[model samples]
Target chain A: MRTGTGAGMPQRGAVGAEERIRAAAVRLWSERGFHGVGIRELAEEAGLSSATLYHYMGTKEDLLADVMSRGLRRLVLAAERVTQQRAGAGPRMNALVQLHVLTHALRPRETRVVDGELRALSGDRRGGVMSLRDEYERYWRATIDEGRASGAFRVEAPGMARLALLEMCTGVARWYDPGGPMALSEVALGHAQLASRVLGAEELELVDEVDWCRGLVGEIWSGPGGG
Target chain B: MRTGTGAGMPQRGAVGAEERIRAAAVRLWSERGFHGVGIRELAEEAGLSSATLYHYMGTKEDLLADVMSRGLRRLVLAAERVTQQRAGAGPRMNALVQLHVLTHALRPRETRVVDGELRALSGDRRGGVMSLRDEYERYWRATIDEGRASGAFRVEAPGMARLALLEMCTGVARWYDPGGPMALSEVALGHAQLASRVLGAEELELVDEVDWCRGLVGEIWSGPGGG
Candidate 1:
């Protein structure tokens, strides 16, 4: 999972200030990477004094973990919602791919932070992020397994298929542009179709619904519960 | 084409010493990223004095361009070889996917530098890398187009499918471990099958010869032209 469906946010208290700091951290960290940026520069980017930054975000590594975990939490929540839908495995997988694509396209910076900075964290911090990542992927694994069990898919390698689909969906963050010719909804739908074909369920018809996934992304990344 | 099959290498002389330096550059750059590493540190890691580093590898950015171009050149060569085979679109595509999987799985660090550090290059250097990458993917685009023309594929979105498949194959670098239980050849064959299915060609026979691809990778990466 290159874009492992997570980033960060302020925990509680001083909510506005913390969110501002986090937003800046995601932007800089994604741009320069976790080890490349300095604390002072992060503070400057967030318009906070260095002393104030330490108080608000703690150490840089802590801030990184927070950003990655928060981003991942949103992804996990979206996956859970899709899995719990009344739709069966095929539609559920469609929604899952669409949701992952939309989130990555709309929130590339945060996703990059989550995808590229795992090495910067130490033991417990890394473990926590990995745990969250595992939970998010579990939704994907279960969905694929269900589809396979029902003979809805013909994938020869389920584990490889899950990873391939994830990387395919996440690549949107690297290449998709809001200002580009492709519409966001179109990108999501196209990816869903590609995913269905990859999973050998093109005959089953992907329960294509970009509008639903779009709404979910809007709620997660920009919604009150998101950041 | 985020992992568009390229990195860097030495342009002028210093043959053996230069290859060693570039090898170390790939390791350090892939591990710590371009910005996170310094010339002095690169020199130390390469077992060369700072002065000798410049003599062998030129500037750091120049070194990066060389590494990327060299890597891309190898991929382009492999892609060319596959495309030239008498096999039709299905086999060519399978071989391309298998070759990609093998290269990324066997040479994860080099591929990571190729995939992750595009922003590290500048101006003409970036353009040089991009041109090489474009040339490499032209093979893939051509193969997909050929499949569609022959009624061998059912892909609805050709451009998106190419990107999706490339990202999916490139993902072998991110998750594959040589120490893992899955055999290397199994990974390659599974990806080829997944690719064939994704391109809507599951009913068509994929020219699944990972052994052939394995041989090509050996010749390309360790061949006389590669180093």
Candidate 2:
């Protein structure tokens, strides 16, 4: 999805300048990464004076902490929502995969900023963000474990499997180009299929199997559609 | 796997100033990421003057480029060596997995800098590094295609399978710590198992499956032992 458009638009509405600054920080942090950007440059990018930025987010590190904490909080919230909607591990995992793929594809910048800029935050901030990340990881781990236990999934190590699945999803932010071949929905679906394979889901029976197989063949022949 | 120590001990052969600078750069880059560390700070961290630092590496960006390029070159070289040694696609893929796992476990910092700092390099430097990376990807892609054609690997899409497998291995650099539970060899082995699974080779009763499985389990339990 294009930035500055859609429902996920940064709150630049009549909101306070502080909110605008935070939104700008998220955008820049995602694009250039925390270490690559400076406070003055970030302020300029946001169309605000460095003094105003200071007044809004306090310090450069503080801006980073705020951006990361807020983004991670959103991720945690999204995971919680998915967990609440789906009862079983398989459905919940599918929901998690969908949520992860959609969020990353839609908010590529924000997700990148949060995932790549963790070390820039101070110790306390880093700890808080990491705790949230661990919690998010736990959800995935539990889902994989449940799938394995229930014979819905066959994986060697649930922990490692979860990590691999998360890595595949997180990498979407790195290479996903909205203008590229595949649509966001398509990428999410492809990722769900790959996740299913990673979890060792049984082959779909007859009717579903042929359709799924055809979809994959179509995807392969399509040749690197939009991320 | 500790920094400043390699397999051989060349007695009385002290590290050159340039080597020391590169070493310092690796440490800083790994800790704070490429764009996070300033030249002056890096010099201070290396216990060298800023002027002296320039004599060793032309610019901060040059330092990053050199580090990334060298690391990627090493990775590519290693992968090539493995491929050359193994005759066919199956054994070649196995070697590639083992080599990749060992490299990640042995040279975690270099792996981190190469994977995380790709954005820091500019123009030709960035293109050069990316080309090398693409070349490395080609090795895996070719192997996957061969396996699929030969009926050794049972994957619906070869390209996506390559990407997924690469993502899984690259993730080792992020969370692997040397001293954790398993040894480096163990972690590499575990990754080999994961790689085999990703390639859809488990269904094939290939030779050396037992060894590959052992390596996979070991790498998993090792958790990137804290080098």
Candidate 3:
């Protein structure tokens, strides 16, 4: 499930010291499961001391919830924009799928942590994380239900279709590679079409807003109060 | 992501010692992940000492490989059966979707280890594990390609469709719960229809062989030379 090699998945090279720690945390946490990663290794990966690591992020659980929250929050904002930017429900749904595929492909580690490690959070921490997740999923459910009501999409079980399409689109995080022949745009288009088909649409629509989505992801993920 | 609690997931209440070890491995490995699990806890769960654990399954890697291989082999056999059970490629693909969803639902731990820990294997072990996976996926690819050739499944990219459908069906493993309101039968049927839609089929066909698939899975996983 690990993507980058021993060099530790390069950063922007302009990230601040604290941001570097956050990035390293996401990378190491994804490459090695949370329990498999240690404080010293994390500090080493971040080029900082364990004490300084605590300065930037509280506990490991605090850092984990921070990562998960940031990823889900950005997704929610992106989902809100994509579902509203386009005029019709069908087009909004199409845009949502394309944007989701692109974001997941771009931030595989962050998305993977969000998808795979919710069980690790507990108590109020778990509640906060799950609430953000619920907020993110609400956009998807609302769009699907709107499409179904508008006669833009047909599905016997809208909830099932939502789960299926979300899982289908989120899978881009698992195998997407920029070095490979498959481009991020191609993945977005393909997953959008698949999502359409999954929802029982008679015809598929392609959305071309990759740059917009990329900018939005950057703004949301790195913006103030993101993590 | 954890399945059951305390009672250790309630196996048939009667199984051989080796089977008990296998069950324990799946539960622990799924909850804590492979690296997070240790032999002592595994042995304790199986009601045996570490010596007996090593006796039954050689090394930890051997046991990991055994667990992964058993899941994949059973899937491949079930894929073979389901793909050949019906005459047309459509029904075959439908059955494959249902069987996959059902199997993943019933045995999330096995499927999780198989999907998430492929990189944990190295050298000949990795090769052997991936070969079984390729064999399993070949049935999916062949069925999809056959459907495309026969004009039964409409798809722009058959490979993408195959990946999408497989991931969609397999997502059941991450979320399906026996105590939840969504019945296993409903999940099977819903995913079958969703698979048909993802492949761009105009009509959804129901597959009636769920029990047969369940039986075949038990037989294959329990059969000799399987694990």
DockQ of all predictions against the true structure, Cα-based? 0.61, 0.40, 0.63
Between 2 and 3, whose TM-score is larger? 3
In order, candidate lDDTs are 0.84, 0.69, 0.80
lDDT of 1 by residue, B92-141 (tens): 89888889999999888888988888888999999999999999999999
Over the stretch A1-227, how does candidate 2's per-residue lDDT look in tens digits?
12233355554432446656776777766655677678888888778889988876788988777767777766776677667766777777876776776677666777788777776776897898889889888789888888888898887766667776888788777667789865666666666777777788745211122233234333432321111
Superposing all C-alpha atoms, what RMSD in Å does each candidate have to the true structure? 6.2, 7.9, 6.4
**Candidate 3: pairs in clash:** none
lDDT (tens digit, per residue) of candidate 3 on B154-203: 88888878888888888888878899888888888888888887787767
Tell me which of candidates 1 and 3 scores higher on TM-score: 1
Residue A186 of candidate 2: its Cα lDDT?
A: 62
Model 1 TM = 0.90
Residue-by-residue lDDT tens digits, candidate 1, A1-227: 02222347334445656777888888887887887788999899878799999997899889989989998999998888888884688888888888999889888998998877888898999999999999999999998999999999878788878888898888898888789888888889888888887787877675667888888888878853253
In model 2, the runs with Cα more than 4 Å from the true position are A1-15, A47-52, A181-183, A204-227, B1-15, B46-48, B181-186, B204-227
Which prediction has the highest DockQ against the true structure?
Answer: 3
Residue range with the least summed lDDT across 10 consecutive positions in model 3 chain A:
A1-10
Give the TM-score ranking, best first: 1, 3, 2
Tell me the TM-score of model 3: 0.87
Residue A59 lDDT, candidate 1, scale 0-100:
93
Give TM-scores of chain A for all candidates. Answer: 0.90, 0.79, 0.86
Instruction: Compare the candidates by TM-score and give the number of the best one.
Output: 1
